[model samples]
Target: MVTPVRVVIALCLFVPFVAMLWVGSYAKTDPAFIGIPFFYWYQMAWVLISTALTMIAYQLWRRDQRGRSSRKGGVAE
Candidate 1:
């Protein structure tokens, strides 16, 4: 059970990073965002989103850990 939770957390952390790389690698050249290129802006936006997702994952991981501990003690209510 805990192993699955850990794996999910790892995937959540990694998938966004891969997505960022993919977006960066295939972005166009023109249509700059306020002078910044599409390649640059897209990566920057993903960086912010990734930070948010990481924070959310961390919170969920902490909650899962707490639940596991409480369940072990039969006090999870």
Candidate 2:
């Protein structure tokens, strides 16, 4: 259970970072978005997504920690 959760959290944390890197490699002038280049908007969008993903990862980690603490309590008595 914890392993799967950890994998999911790791993916959530890493995917956006990889996307930002991929978008950064593209040319800015070829395709534009609302007068801004693809490079700029893509990175900006990923920044927002990254924040959300990070929040999700934090929540998952907290949940995992809580579960561990509860299990410990069960074993102690």
Candidate 3:
């Protein structure tokens, strides 16, 4: 019983993994930020991005769980 909300949650969780693992995409120094190399800055940026994504996924999961429980006539925990 896959739902659009669930798919969005999955994407939120998966995007960071793909972005970090795809090193070739950020493995360079041409785009420096405040003297920090692209490789370094990119990884740091992803850290923040990953945290945001995780938070979003967590919220969506909680919302989905609440919806499921309510539909079953159970109180959300």
- Number of the predicted model whose lDDT against the real structure is largest: 3
Report the C-alpha lDDT of model 3 over 1-77, residue by residue, as the tens digit: 89999999999999999999998999999788999999999999999999999999999999999999989999877
lDDT for model 2, on a 0 to 1 scale? 0.81
Each model's C-alpha lDDT?
0.79, 0.81, 0.94
lDDT of 1 by residue, 1-77 (tens): 45877887887799787887686574786778899988788778888888887987898788887888787986433
Number of residue pairs clashing in candidate 1, backbone atoms closer than 3 angstroms, sequence gap of 3 or more or interchain: 0
Clashing pairs in 3: none
Candidate 2 residue runs with Cα over 4 Å from true position? 23-25, 74-77
Q: Give the top-scoring candidate (TM-score).
A: 3
**TM-score of each candidate structure, all chains considered together:** 0.71, 0.79, 0.94
lDDT of 1: 0.79
lDDT of 1 at 43: 76
Model 2 per-residue lDDT tens digits across residues 1-77: 65988998999998986786675476466578789877777778888999999999999988887887797875322
Error of 3 at 7 (Å): 0.2
Better of 1 and 3 by lDDT: 3
RMSD of 3: 1.2
